[model samples]
Target chain A: MVHNLWTELYIVLLLLAAVVIISQCYITYLFHKYEQAKIWKVIGILFPLGLNIYIYQIIKLEKRLNNFLQIASMERRDWRTAYLLVLAQYLLLFAVFGLFASP
Target chain B: MSKRSKARIIFFLYILVLLCFDTTYSFMIFNLFLAFAALELSFLLPLFRIRNNKEIVMSMFFVVTFILLSPNAIYVVTDLIHLTFFDFDFMEGLELKEWWNFTILVSGVFLALFYYVLMMDQVRAFLGRSKWMNLILLLMIILSSIGVYIGRFLRFHSIHIFTEPLTVVFQIVHSLDYSSVLFIGWMTILQIIICWLFLDEVGVKNGT
Candidate 1:
């Protein structure tokens, strides 16, 4: 019975991660459109496997955009709390999984 | 030398000492070393200015290699299952040799995790803390979790992806059951929590 509860919680956490990843992808798309970044770079952003490479290219463009447009970007701290909440949820998930998954 | 470089040197020395001390588990240390090397190469590859097609292709090759090997780092954690091989009985009291073996195994695991945390920090510093950066990290964790599942349960090494690509792919697809999903989910969450703890340490260190 306890194992079932942990499994349910694990599924919930996985669902939450999926939602965050999908929403972040959408946000990245919008950023690409607003910035009028290169189409290929944006396409590469959609491919999570090569994300680091594409991110490097997009960040270079963002630096140029920052200089030319003087647009303010979101502070890292703004996302810190949300990230912490996710981390706490996952840590709880890990603890439960560790406790119940072992014989 | 920079602080990061100093840390790398210290870590290397620690690995050497562990290698010398534990002959039976030297292969695990070697695996950890190779994984760390792949990560370092991947991190350094981006530093080179991409001038032409050849450079771009080479960089992509290293990126792929990095992804393939990254799972080995966390795969060491699963080595804890080998603890069952050792004798541990509270009623009989602790055995020094068994306890020593446990220490060596755990130290190697912790070193692997530290390598992972350091790599993440390096990537964050390179990309800057943005939504894109976080997304990339999430993708990496997800990929590594899948990779670990393949490595641990399916018994496929990273090189198998190159030599037996079709077979490896088929096995991975065939092995998609509830237990595999659960294992992958557990690994993903565990990694994220470790990364978060590292981030908190950086914040505290920087007085942010």
Candidate 2:
């Protein structure tokens, strides 16, 4: 009985992970469309486990974007807030899966 | 040196130092060597050209070999069971016993964690911007769990698949019982959780 329950939990967790990954990709797409972030860096963000790479790429783009805005004499909108929320969503999903599926 | 190369050097040096203290157990050294080889293969696997037909074929071979051997890294945890075979009287052999125990346990766990991180980073590099990143990681974890079982309980090394293909295939096909399924499932969950925690911490540190 316990074994069956664990197996079911595993399946559920796997499905949750799939959903989270798809959503992460979608969020990146949205950011790329509206914020003019580079498509390649946004694509790099899809790597679920490459958090360091993702942060590095995002920071690089943000810094460049800040310089461009400064030269253009424009105010910088808080676009990073959207990306942070998406990250938090996937992270919470991972924590939930870990908590429920651990033996 | 790059972060990845630095890690590889540190891991190699660590194994060398530990080998001095682990003289009684040669198999452990062999297992670690296989794990180290797998990490190196993973590091190289992502560099192949995905667009060129020849390069794609070569990279697929690397991918298959990596999946087959990466579990040897995780199987380090199972090596701790060997400690039960040793006879140690706490009062009589406390010093030697404690030292050996610490060496095995610490090295085993450290190598496992390092290999796990190395594999994850390499795989992410391979998957670079793929839409199915999470699904791929989940599948790799499931396969690694089964591979761990084949290594631990069946006493089959990764190279045995090449030398005794038929016997290895038969054993793996026959071992897919309910208990093994449950075992693999739990192990998959544990491995995923560990990797997630490690990567998340790295993300936090790097992001801040």
Candidate 3:
């Protein structure tokens, strides 16, 4: 039973990582289309394991999109999806590591 | 909210979550904080406009501090050795706690590398794109690898450079050997690959 639980948890974590990577890729596409996309942003899609979402957040907050029409057409919340996914990934990892285990 | 404020809040919340899980890892938390602080310093260092000789001197001081603290970020990668604590046989089932610990440790390692890359990116921007800037980055990675070696094997902290400068230097000189040199070279290569993949993509225009 314990082994099964571990497998399930591992699968969940893998799925979360995959979703985060996809979200990051989407964000990179958006940045490329509407803004002065950074190389780091492209690299983030290729290696979504670390720093991509954080970089996305930093860029989103620091600069406005070059094409105002694109910004107006897109929902504001669209830009935040990757950030939320990354946060969820961290929260899940920490919650399992910290709260579920007995001291 | 400002970028700095948002980053701080996220970092604070991360710490709070970790503390809530286990206070025994306070030392790890402290190290993470130090790495985060160094990353923030690097990010902020570029924004400072030097107006006079005094400002330039202060900026230089902060630059040195950033370089010294920067190694702590990469040093976190060495902490993966702790994962050996969860020794389990294939014959036996894995425990939930052990599995979670493994997950957390790997995540922490990734996060630390991420921090190192982000910090280097900021420093790269501060230095601008040039052959000399690339050389400086290579030099920084080599120094950081040596710093990791010193920290991991010598068990010396970065602060020791200021407090016990002679002993630290002496120990570093004496500790030189084939194995240590090999380790530093391997680490430097690993860091360069990471930088090449993440920070130095070819054919991509630099973002403003």
Candidate 4:
């Protein structure tokens, strides 16, 4: 039973990792598309593990997009709030792991 | 005064406290310190930007030492196996007795993670803007995963590369077992993931 739970935990961890990576990669794509930031593309490809870099890029990209739209008097919703959600999810993930990891 | 330096000092202080409680683990701490020092040497060498041939050769020496010892940082994770040896039998009325084991285990995990992240950053910096950076990162992951396996299950220390070079080579020449393959495979992937997460959170903002 414990082995089964551990396996399930591992599966959950893998899924969590996959979700983070996919979202981060998409964020990198958004940066490239909207901000014309080819440097993020280089970093995304070369240092694919730079999640924080991706987050930073996404935040900057959002600000730039908002600024560009604002010149036309159009308002864009702030998506930087996603960073807080990501932080919370990671904290919860660790909490779950700690709860189940005791042998 | 930098954040990294402050983290390093905290790591050492934690180790010192651990040693005070359990002096028998001095050898393990000594081995870890050697690995940490080798990593710092590697990280700092490139910053010097030596142009002369003599200086280049000296830098190469440090690079070799770093390559040999950096795996020891990853290898430190395997030292978690040592926790099984601790006497867990509870003594009544002993203040913070049972909690000591928990403290040691958590601190060791933090320290190992700290070392691994720093070493990975230094290595990426060492590789700096190479055209083949991706390929190099892939190569490092594979090689370091193998290095960790050899260090852990094969009982080979980094110093053995110098003292028993031939034996080390001979052992590595042999076939890899199933566990070694799985260990290497997962470790490589996880190492890359952790490396990505640990890099600057602000990304390339402010032209960093």
- DockQ (C-alpha based) per candidate is 0.02, 0.02, 0.02, 0.01
Q: List residue ranges in candidate 2 displaced over 4 A.
A: A1-103, B1-3, B86-93, B202-208
Chain B TM-score (each prediction, in order): 0.84, 0.83, 0.87, 0.80
- Report the lDDT of model 1 for residue A65: 37
- How high a TM-score does candidate 2 get? 0.59
Per-residue lDDT of candidate 4, residues B92-166 (tens digit): 455364456656665665676676776666566667698897788678768788888887767776656653578
Task: Tell me the TM-score of candidate 1's A chain.
Answer: 0.36
lDDT (Cα, tens digit) per residue for candidate 3, span B81-138? 8877777565687677777666666666776776777778777877766769989999
lDDT of 1 by residue, A53-82 (tens): 325433553254331122223322222222
Tell me model 2's lDDT, rounded to 2 decimals.
0.60
Interface quality of candidate 3 as DockQ:
0.02
Looking at model 3 chain B, report the run of 10 residues with the lowest lDDT sum.
B199-208
User: Which regions of candidate 3 are displaced past 4 Å?
Assistant: A1-103, B1-10, B23-26, B48-51, B200-208
Q: Which CAPRI level is candidate 4?
A: incorrect
How high is the CA lDDT of each candidate model? 0.60, 0.60, 0.65, 0.57
Off by over 4 Å in 1: A1-103, B1-3, B22-24, B48-54, B200-208
Query: What proportion of the true contacts does each candidate reproduce?
Result: 0.00, 0.00, 0.00, 0.00
Give candidates' CA RMSD values in order.
Answer: 17.2, 17.4, 16.2, 21.0
